[model samples]
Target: MKRILLFSLLLPLSVSSQSNDKMCETLSKINALVKENHFQPKPVDDSLSVFVFDKFIDGLDENRNIFTKSEYEKLSKHRLLIDNYIAKNDCSFMNDFVSIYKKALERKKSVLEKLETVSLDYNSQDSVKFSKDQFPFDLTENDFDRVWKKRLRFDILEDISKLSKNADSLQLHFTEIEKTIKQRVFDTNLCKVNSILNNKNGVKSILKNDFLNAFCYYFDPHSNYFSFDAKSSFLSGLSTSNLSLGIEVSMNERDEIVIEEIVPGGPAARNSKIEVGDVVTKVSNTKGEEYWVSCSSMETIGEMIFSDHNKQIELTLRKKNGTTIAVLLKKKVMKATANAVYSFIAEKDAKVGYIKIPNFYADFDERSPKGCADDVAKEIAKLKKDNISGLVIDLQNNGGGSMAEAIKLAGMFVNAGPISVLVDNNHNQNIINDFFRGEIYDGPIVILMNGYSASASEFFAAALQDYNRAVIVGSTSLGKASMQTIMPLEENNENDFVKLTIEKFYRISGESHQIKGIIPDVFAPVLFDSLIKRENSFKTALPYNAITTSTKYNPLPKNITSEIINLSKTRIDNDLRFKELKSINEEINFTYNKPRNPVRLTFTDVFKEVHDIDSLWEKVKNATEKENSLLIYNTSYDTKKLASDDFQREINTFKLKDIKSNPYLEEAINIINDYKKFKQ
Candidate 1:
């Protein structure tokens, strides 16, 4: 029935006036393209042709450029519905596709206009309303975790009406839940008044925060509504994405930046008497005096931290025992130290150099010195330094970044030529450059990708694969081949705005990164397959990877197929940890088996478990008391020692080590050691 409907729709597309055979031939060609290229097609005679065409338009906008010119010409010819667009009475698929698409656009004209208003006053900071109410958000420093929850709740977006059934119901339900939240806050607020506490500051603090967050709720996740104070702060926070002194800090009773996470081999990683929990009470310039920089009363502190570029800051610290100390450190722009790991792995393979490109962000301006280009060049220098081996670019989890970066990065591997092709519904094509001037790492290359690799990562990997520079390994990458555009909510808050899918990218070979992300040449599952975080929003994320045919280059393998396979098998067999992990994961899968109805164990089962637990605890406690006579005494009740010989004699019988603390992490280390040969 569906096929008959399609055929009938095709009949109307060309009309019986001309040759019916000619119309059928056109339909057949279009079908072949759709089938061969993995292109998803809308139903014939459906309004979807226009939607696809408009979607193509959106993708080519400032933020989304992926298709090539040749692709556009082919698709444009395929767009004909009933009228002549390019040549009158041509009756080609492109003309018909365009006509149908234009009609669809006319119908959706209002919806497009409605989208324009999405940037206006969305979740503006001006709308933040504060009250004495703190219902679900009453917290001391000890309740720091609770603060995060409240802040996240207030961050919910509204204002833009969802497209009916296309909205998240859970999000809408939370909108309604705000009423009850306020009532509870009101109850708590009243109780506070009875205590005669000076909570005006606290109330004002919360109100201000709500106003700012609610404003950002109007835009995409990355868009943020910031206060004048926060504008200075966002700039500094962005520095973290680039490069900075490898330091992670937190505030204390006396507020400061306390270093926490340190990347190994980084300048600040360990070259210090400083410890993790030391507080950065104050930071000063080269002058020895402490500067009165304030992180107080502000939601963000990075503003002050990065305000002074290429300068030294004297950091005064309050130690854990309340001792004061100071440390002066110079700032250095840090590079992601991921390359060394790969280089080490490829050291043994005299024929393989490794490059793990997480994302492509090239700060290609006089403003910044280090970027994807600089980093890649440095790594290439290293690979070349070794004087041996092919190259393997590990792009496992890289989502994507700038097109310029992707293009430039792709150029590093391949010699000059066309990289990828972009095709729009109008059959327009654009050629992406593949410039390679010198120092091409022309060796047997392999690109390691997985379901998580996407976007610019896909572009880099696909370009390499298209150019025959690398063989893709692992499963199909995440198909997010589409592009997006960012439009700000207000000129005042440049950071806050709408990020929408704008365009689709096609490989030079004409493959969309959409649903079918880059398929791996070799399907080897990663070692930590059981640990992938799947309960995420990614399942609903828009198409960023789509597929099309090659625009220019065609790559073939160097016949290392059996070698890679042999290596994989040897590692799997020898690595006991991999085997154990595989076994354990299989058990976990069974534990989470989906069922039509959830299991409801009877009351008897609950009784059995509780009785067993109680018995087990009692037995353990008894054994502990006997083994450690003094240490296993009382948890809540403290025993008073008598000023007598008997008490002293009793205390002497205890051993401290007999009673153990929770040893899960240690147990894990031991387990790994058992399989250290190939698994750890």
Candidate 2:
């Protein structure tokens, strides 16, 4: 898997700033490298300059709260000059931009501090509608005052609604609780402003990175620039480490820190309350020091979790159901396999082996030569020995890694053919084939995917679909077929790095699933497709294209393919849970996509609104909980291994619990059975 740079918080904050000359030198190098090596690099002209300028400004003030309309107008003078600046290796425009942005930050800091000391009128009829697109920049100083108060009032009202929901359980005094919630809102906002102003290297360091990363990001969403310390911290996540809560997180488009995955065999896996896609709103330690994620940067949040000082902590996570839950957890020593692939058997009408690959993780460390493909091969062998009639490989939420491992894993199912095609920057194509000569366990196979199954995952799934090697299931895969690799800024110097999109992957049919992604043969009610960002969600994402290739291969018989699909569709259409899930998906779409109107700040009004949304999500939360769960169990070999360790067994039990109730997996089992029946 791609290494997460969790240790960035450990880097020293009190560091000397780079000179403008130094910054320009770095930018020049980056510009040259990207243009030369990027898969489809755009020219460094007016278009690129404008993109970088707008992106930099947006990154600095995403909420459009900091910069006034006039200030923004003043800054737009250098919009078209950025390309010229880069061509001349000049830092004058950036220097001017930073000087102006700093002033804006100082002004914003003052406004926040002033707002904190006073109690705002929560009873006001005025309301605030949050929309990234609809929200306008402050037109004047008076507008700033109005907007800030609305923002603060909205925050307080939200918390009040949350606290009052449990008033009966807590026997809360409304007036006192309101005061406490107001103080929290004030403290959180002020803290956010102060942290940025107090940055030791100044805002220049942060903005400089943003400015440079704009070019890299515009090339493709995956490309990035890393400073020396940043590079080290990012690469550090490749190794197995301890003192982890056993979860991985990502900042969503809304700037909410969302739990992306729960590491198996980790503390989080054991907790029934913790789950994927929960938004972490607040974090606190046993010492009663609490930090709100809304107010803190991701780096700050990382320090709070990974720091040696805080071992016991409580995370206040906001579930999609519009409810908040506090999960008390402690850091534990976890093993490398906490993130590894594991398998189980789902028994219904037939015995089907289910293998869950968290990601296409290759052993980056020399000491551990076992890659995901090798582990998968071993799992298949065990399942074959157990006499499984069919197999299900789960790639749900797998954000893919190691292209080499994906090729190897895909090879295990397909009998010798061109698995995929790779296209380089210069328009040269190379066919990536499964030359393994024979299949491992090719008895009817099903691959499960969701919106988060990206990169190498899409590659593997697309190949199987192309050759009719496996039946693809679930909603849709994350449409990202491009490959990226890191290169040093200076030759042989590992300190400064830039991850660039080097090539794109195509199916043996020559269709590139860039932003289009892979459409499953059978569509189930998509559980995780809500706010599940995909390639098309990214503005800079590459477009889908197809090429004419001469490679020939035969697919599974048309009659069999159509028969299996029809059988599965008939079963899904009649299932109550599946119908409920589909209804839930539609409601979720309406709730998120319909233009949000200004929500009245009154407790009664806000409470009703929150309740409606919460109820909808409650349905979503329990939609897949089958009254009659599938019979899921570990294989004999895994059961024997788990028998030796209680912790491993506990984790195994949790995995089975998920497998038992999963509607997607249940349907996959049904499909596999359908395939087996058709064959007979």
Candidate 3:
């Protein structure tokens, strides 16, 4: 199935003037880059280095990233092999290279086979520990189909190495590699045609999962790729594909799929016939096509779900005690619970109430009139009943939703006016204006943010900060203050792309939020950074830059700006979390950012810093997770209304972490207190 590779397009990027340094300088810079990212180019053989050979291979396939800990550790240990391969200037290393190639392929197939049967025990508290625990899973597959997923990645690199010979042929091989990877999935899923497939909910979920697995493989590890359908479904907390009739699946110690949770209203929930800890053996559709999907088969089960949502699915399930039950189910629509919820916590001045904006979702048609804007308005009305003292807006981990939402939400804090601007790749501008004529939640206001507050989250918080409408608190926002909009393509099988920042956002005051996240006037440390380390951030992200000036509204009192800079650094130094973050940052070496063939002093510095940061980052992560659990339990009280009719009574209490550890909110409360007094 190898089709001719279409290489008429894809011109190589022009080497930048910055990259035009001498060979030695280039080599040194490249060395530092490699070390920072932990890359290696090993020799494939004596005739032709593996690195050179791998060039085509790398281009042909993207990583499936299903390596077990042992596999990854093996790669890490033998990384020099890759370097040797890359170092080979000529194709002298063929025989040995072939051996290495064969061995690597065998290893990848063996590992991938085992992963097919692997499923997580989400209920296990020990699950997250895998990040720290490293490889703990079992890999036990038979021979991989020729040119499987990981094999394709390696093959592409090989193709690249033999460029003169493979330029035309490699592209053909690349196409075949993709086709086989996809076909293997379809083949493997056939193993799942047990009567258990009768569950309509399970079927849809299975199908939706197919899309997720395929979609996710396209982006950088942290970034995600979603199909247009999946994207729409996710934005509104709806995944029609996977609503349970009441069965949740897990794998037993023997690697068998286990059923865990059943929803109350689900068909499985009402039947009392099925019990927890049940294991699934076979699945089928109403038409009775028995699932051929076995642990070793290469078909995709989810694709089956995609076949027909309207059809009933049948599942052949085995109870732990050894009884098998044939259950048939119809799928139903299920709503996704909001990641973050809002409530009116306290009526401070018979007018001020608190609101928390969780992660943002713009909703269908990409229209999110309610994500933050409408939610804020509703929360304000409820909080207004108390003659509220002042309001607090919490934006912790609200990585942002629609830009429209940010502007509309921010307008709720101020009296009126334009809040932000959106510019496209060509730098054309679309200005978003907000004029709030409604009851201003006019009391003393505080906007709460944390390091995870990014994108639209930062935009809204910055507006409040700049306007002096609210005193901002908590850690500095995540520096991802950029924008992107999806663009439809003419022939889209899946090539439709999103255009990201060609232009920038300027505050009403004409200040840019690029690279530099909004700085809070009042500061509180996120406890996670106190324990975890975070150096080398600049390496992983886009360069921070600014755009030329444009007209915008200015809000803050001029003196507040200077006071903020002086005070922020002082607060940061004193904060336990920031102190720890700085300690980690300072230890990073310059060599990670510079060239290192001669091993400059900078490289030495960077290596030292990396070690320090690595150690600290672990400690911080463990500390934050553990600490938040304790803090949440200790501090939050289920707030009840003084009057039964009060909306506050209906509101839920912040879990323990939300209640006790927010020194930032405490600081904001203090700021509000001062603002109230100062105005008098």
Instruction: Estimate TM-scores for all models.
Output: 0.43, 0.92, 0.48
RMSD of each: 22.7, 6.4, 17.4
Stronger candidate by lDDT (1 vs 2): 2
After superposition, the stretches of candidate 2 with alpha carbons farther than 4 Å from their true spots are 1-18, 166-172, 228-240, 253-256, 288-290, 293-303, 336-339, 528-530
Q: Give model 3's TM-score versus the native structure.
A: 0.48
Which of the predicted structures, 1 or 2, would earn the higher TM-score when compared with the native? 2
The TM-score measured for candidate 1 stands at 0.43
* Candidate 2 lDDT over residue span 111-134, tens digit each: 878887777776879876767483
Ranking by lDDT: 2, 3, 1
Q: Give the best candidate by lDDT.
A: 2
lDDT of 2 at 455: 90
User: What digit string (tens of lDDT, one per residue) describes model 1 on residues 1-680?
Assistant: 99999999888655533433443343343333322332232243323334334333432221111223343354554333322221233433333333433333332333323332332222323222333322221223333223222332232221111112223453356445434533433333233232222334333233223323322221222222233444345434644634455565544323335665444434455355465556665556664434332323233235335544435656666554344466666666565442322232122212234455656776656596556756777666665665534555667657678777787878877777778776553445677876656436665556667666777888788887776565565667766665555544435544334333434567776666566677775554343343343212332333344354445654545344444544554554455444443454464454334232311122222223223233333433343233211112211111232234343323222211222221111121222222222222
Candidates 1 and 3 compared by TM-score, better number: 3
**Ranking according to TM-score, highest score first:** 2, 3, 1
lDDT of each: 0.44, 0.80, 0.46
Q: Which portions of model 1 miss their true places by more than 4 Å?
A: 1-262, 265-346, 349-352, 364-370, 423-428, 435-439, 450-452, 474-476, 489-496, 524-540, 543-550, 557-577, 587-680
Angstrom error at residue 561, model 3: 9.6
Task: Give model 2's TM-score versus the native structure.
Answer: 0.92
